[model samples]
Target: MFSELQTEIEARYDIHFDDLSLLEEALTQANYINEHPNYHGRDYQRLEFLGDAIMQQSSAVYLFKRYPDWDEGRLTELRILMVQTRSFAALSRELHLDHYVQLGHGEEISGARNRDSLLEDLWEAFIGALYLDQGQDAVMNLLEQVFFSKIDTGFYDRFVDYKSKLQELLQKNGTVDINYQKISEEQIENNEQIFTVAVQLNGKQLAVGEGKSTKDAEKVAARRAYKDLTMDK
Candidate 1:
C-alpha cells in the first residue's frame, strides 16, 4: 500500500521519505490503533495538529511574499481559501495520499480510509512527520512540488472573497451597512453540515447562498450581494 505512495511521491513531488517508519506513522489513522491491542497506542492526531499550524504559516508566508500588492483583507481571504479542508482534500487526491493511510478493520470496512476529511488530516500529519524527520526545508520543498507549484495568481484572485471587495467598494461609495444572517442549518451526509445564509444591506435581503458552513455560506451570499449591488449601480 505504502510502496505505491512512495513511488507516487518520488515521481510526482521528487521527495522520498528517508525513514520508512516515520512515513508509516504519519499515515496511521486514529482508527488503526483501536483494533490492535498489541499496537501500543500511537496515532497521528498530534502530528496533524502541528502540521495544520505549519501548513497555515507556510501558506501565509508564501502568499505574503507572492502577493505583495494585495491588501490585508484580500490576502486573508485568499489564505483562508488556500488552507480550507476542501483545498487540502484536493491536494490529497492529487497526490493519491489516501492510498497510504492506515486504518483499522472497522474504519477500513467503513471506507473511512478514503474519506476526504481523514485523508486531509493524514496529509497534514505526513507534512508534520516530514518536518520532524527531515526539517523545514525538506517539507517546504515537498509542499512546493505537490501543492504550491499549482497555485497561480489567477487562482488566488478567484478564491478571494468578493464580498470583501464589495465592502471596500461600498465604503468608497459612502454606504456602510452590511450584514449576514443564517437562515437554516442541516447535517448532511458524510459528517458535513450545510448552512443557508442571507446577505443583507440596509435591512434588506440582497442574496443568499448554501454551503458546508455558516461562514462559507455567508461568504458566498456576500459574493452574490456584491455582484447584485455592483450591477444595480
Candidate 2:
C-alpha cells in the first residue's frame, strides 16, 4: 500500500523496511485515524513518544562522546535546541516527509500537514518506526545524516550555551560545585535593567558577565570563563 513512499524513502535513506506497516503508522496522523473511524490504521502519537526518547538517547550519547569538553548543562541545552519542535519540522521538510503525511479531510483543509507540531510528530514517529523495524543502529544512521553531520560541518556550533560548556570543562575529572552569584541589577539609560553575575569555581571567582537577567549574566560569565580555559589549554 505504501510502495511508492517506501521506494522513495528507501532510495533516499539507503535502507529497506521489513515491515511496511511501520512506515504506514509513522505517516498516519491522529486526525486521519478519526476520519477512518472503523479503520484499523494506527496513529503516530505512540510512535512519536517512543521516537522522542530514542532521539534523546542517540543525541545524548553522540554529544557526550563527540564534545568531550562540553558540560552536562551545555549538552542538555544543545540537545534541546536540536530536538526542538521546529528543528524536527525542518528536518522532516528537508526529507520531504511532509509530503507523505496521511491527513484527514479537515486537516488537509486546515493545512495541518505543514505545521511544525504535526511535522515534528511525524518526524519522531518515523524515527520510532525505523527503530522498531530495525533497531537503534538504523535510527542512528538517519541521525548521522541529519543531526551529527550538521554538527561536524559547524551548522549548530553557534547555538552552543557557553556557560554550560565551562561547567562541563571544570567537571571533566570529577564532581565540581559551580556557583553563579548575582552581583548587581541596575537600570541603564534606557531604563532597561541590566545584571552582572560572577561565576565561581571552588570559592574563587573565575569570571563575570553582564546581561539583562541573572540567567543571561551567568551564561555570559560562563562563556568568558570557557574562553579563558580554552585559551590557556
Candidate 3:
C-alpha cells in the first residue's frame, strides 16, 4: 500500500534493500491490514517485537562499555532512559520516519501519524527489518549513529529530573523567559498552608498546581507544564 516510499527510504539511508517486502512489512501499521481483509501484506508487529529485544541488548552493551565505573543499578536506569519511548520517538522524528510510515484512513484521520507509541513501534520495526536485510552489524551501526549522537550530547541527563527537563525545554527559545510564580497560599484544616503555583512562559500561564509548600507546588507545576507543553504536541 505504501510502495511509493520504498525509493525515498532507501535513498535517505543509502541502503540497497534486498528484502523490499520485509521493509514494506516493517513500515505497515496493523490498522492498514485490519482495514483490508483480503490484503496479504503483513503488519509491523512481529518486526517490532524482534526490534525491541535487539534494542534492549544493544543499549545494554553500549551502556556497559561506555560507563565502566557505574554499577548495575545505575547502568540499568541509564539503559532504560536511553531506550524509553520518548527517546525512540525523538530518534524517529530526527530520521523523518513519519514520512515513510503507512497508515489506515482511520488512523490518519485520528492523528495517529505523530503518536509517540506509533513512532517508537515503527522505529523498532525498521530496526528489525534492517537487521534482517543486512545483519546485526548494520543495525548496530544505525542505532549508534542515532542513539549515540544523543548520548554524546548528554540528552538523557536533561530528563533525569523532569523539572530540569521542563526548564531546558522552555529555555530553548531564548526570548521566552520562563518562571514558576507563586499564586497564593491558603491555610488548610491542619493549619498547614497549601501553596498554589503557576508556570509562566513569557508572561503566559503554561500550567498551575497546588501543594503543601512552595517547592512542592513548583515541582507539581513543572510536571504539569512539561506534560502540557510536550504531550499535546
Candidate 4:
C-alpha cells in the first residue's frame, strides 16, 4: 500500500522499512479512522507522542555531543528551535512528506494536510514509525542526513539573539541588575577600531568580549556571561 512512499524513502534516505504497516499507521489520521469504522489499525496520535520523545532524545544527544562548548541553556534552546512544531512542520513540507498523509475526505477537502499542526503531527508520527520499524540507528541516520544538517550559523542567528537570550535567562527568577559597559577601544589593523565590553550582574563584572562595535562587543560579552552562568547552574 505504501510502495510509492517506500520507494521514495529508499531513494531519498536509503531506508527500507522492515514492516510497512508501521508506516501506514504513521500516515493514518484520526479523521481517516473515524471515516473508516472497520479500520482496526492505530492513528498517528500515539506515534506522535512517542516520536516527540524520540526526537527530543535524539536531538538532545546530538546537540550535547556536537557542541561541547555550549552551556545547558544554549543547548536546550537550540534543541527546542530544531524540534519545535513549526520546525517539524517546515521539515515535513521540505521533504514532501505532507503529500503522503492519509487524510479523510473532509480533511482533504478542508486542507488539513497543509496545516502546520497536522504536518507537525505527521512528521513526529513518521519518525516514530521509522524508529520502531528500523531501530534507533536508522532514525538517527535519517536525522543526521536531513535534520541536523539544516542547523547552521544561519539557523542560530535567525532563532537566537544572545543579548536577549541572556537577559531572559537571568531575569527568570526575579528582577536582576544586568548591564553592559564598554571598557576600552583601540584602533587595530586596517584602521578598524576594536571595542571591549563587559557584562555585569549585581554590580560585578561577569564576562568580557571584544568586537568591532560596542553593541557587538556587548552582545559577545552577554553571550559569554550567559554561557558561564548557565554552566555554573
Candidate 5:
C-alpha cells in the first residue's frame, strides 16, 4: 500500500525518502498504535508538532519574499490564514493524503481516517518526514509546488478580516453595539458539527449563517451583515 504511494510521491513531488520508516511514521495516527499492542509507543504526534513549526516558518519565508511590500502585521495575518487548520485540511484533501494515513482497526471502522484534524496532522507529519529525509530545501520545494500557485496579489487584497469589516461598517453607521450570538449547534452525519450564528446590530438581527463550526458560522454571518449594511444605504 505504501510502496505505490511512495513511488507516486517521489515522481510527483521529486522527493526520495531516505528512510521509508519516517514516511511510515508520518502516516501512522495515534489510533494505529492502540490497535497493535506491540506498537503502543509509536505515534505521529511529535512529528506533527515539528512539522507544524516547519510549515509555519516555511510559509512565513515564502510570503515574505512573495509580498515584500506587506508590513509585519499584514504578513503575520496572511501567514496565520495560510497555515490555518482549515487550510491545511483543505491541502490534505487536495493531495489525497487521507488515503495514505494509517489508522487502527477501530478508527478505520469509525471513519476516523477521513477526519479533518487527522488529515491536518498527517499533512504536518509528512512535512516533518520530508524535512528529516531531504532537509529544508526539499520541504520548501514541496510547499512551493503545492501552495505557490495559490498565492497571488488577489489573495492579499481579498483576505479581508470579515469581523473587522463588519465592525467598521456597523460603527460608521452608529451601530457599534453589534453582537454575535451562537443560536444553535448540531452534530451532523460524518462527525461534523453545524453551528448557526446570528449577527445582531443595535439589538436588531442583521443576518445569520450556518457552517461547520461556530467560528466559521460567525464569520459567514459577519460577511452577510457587512454586505447588507453596505447595501442598505
Candidate 6:
C-alpha cells in the first residue's frame, strides 16, 4: 500500500520501515484523524513526544562524544542549537519531509504544511516512528547521515544566539531594560500571519524586523539591533 512512499523514503534517507503504518502514523496530524472518522491509526502527537526525547538524547550524546574539550554549558547551548524548532524545521525542509505530511483538508488549505511549528513536530514524529519501526541504532545512523552530517558541514552556524548576544552587549555598560515589542501583525495568504517586532533598549526602539512567528521576528530584531549597535563602535 505504501510502496511509493517507502521507495521515496529509502531513496532519500537510505532507511526503510518494516511497518509502513508507522510512517503513516508519523505523518498523520491530529486534524487528519479528526476529519477521517473511520481512521483507526493514531496521530503524530505521541510520536512527536517520544521523538523529542530521542532527539535530545542523540544531540547530547553527539556533543559529549565529539566535543570532549567543551564544558557542560557550551555543550548544552550547542545541543539547543541542534534540536531547536527552527533547526528541525529547516532539516525537514531540506529532506522534503514536509511534502509527505498528511493534513486535514482544512489544515492543507490553511497552509499548516508550510508552518515551521508543524514541520518541527512532523520531523520529531517521523523520528519517533522510525525508532519504533527500526531501532536505536537505526535512528542514530539516520541522524548521523542526515542531521549530524550537516552539522559537520557548518549547518549550525546559521543558528547563532543573537538575542543573547544583544543582551550581553547592552548590559556591558551597566544594566538597561531590554524588551521586544510587537509593532504589527499582518495576515498573509493561507491564514499565515507575519509578525513585526522591535528590539528596544531603555524603552527606545533599536531595530525592527519581521518573520512568520513572534519568536523568529524577535530573533531577527535582535540580530539587527546587535549589528546596528556594534557597527557604530
Name the candidate that leads on lDDT: 6
Please list all clashing residue pairs in model 6, or write none if there are none: none
Task: Give the Cα lDDT of each candidate.
Answer: 0.79, 0.85, 0.82, 0.87, 0.81, 0.88
Candidate 3 least-lDDT 10 residues: 1-10
Q: Which residues of candidate 5, in runs, are more than 4 Å off?
A: 153-164, 167-173, 176-233
Which portions of model 3 miss their true places by more than 4 Å? Answer: 1-13, 162-233
List of clashing residue pairs for candidate 5: none
Q: Write the per-residue lDDT of candidate 2 for residues 110-214, one digit (tens) a residue.
A: 989789999999889989998999998888887888777886564554456787788789999999889999999999897899999999998899999998889
Return the lDDT, model 4, position 224: 79
Worst lDDT 10-window in candidate 4: 152-161
Whichever of 3 and 5 has more lDDT, that candidate is 3
User: Residue 30 deviation, candidate 6, in Å?
Assistant: 1.1
Candidate 1: what lDDT?
0.79
Give the per-residue lDDT digits (tens) of candidate 6, residues 1-233: 35576887689778898998888898889999999999999999999999999999998998899989888987897798889888899877876778888899999999998999999998998899999999999899889888888876657756888999999998998999999999999999999999999999989999998999999899989988887886644
Clashing pairs in 1: none
**Could you tell me every candidate's TM-score relative to the true structure?**
0.66, 0.67, 0.66, 0.68, 0.69, 0.71
Better of 1 and 5 by TM-score: 5
Candidate 6 — worst ten consecutive residues by lDDT sum? 1-10
- Residue pairs of candidate 3 with colliding backbone atoms: none
Across 1-233, the per-residue lDDT of candidate 1 in tens digits comes to: 66677787888777787776777777887677877777864688888988899999998998899989887886786688778776787777777777777788888899886687887798788888788878889888987876677676334434566778767876896867888889999988898899999977788888998889888898788777786776534
User: What TM-score should be assigned to candidate 3?
Assistant: 0.66
lDDT of 3 by residue, 108-198 (tens): 9998889999999988988888888889888877776778668767676545566787888977867568888999999989788999999
Who wins the TM-score comparison? 6
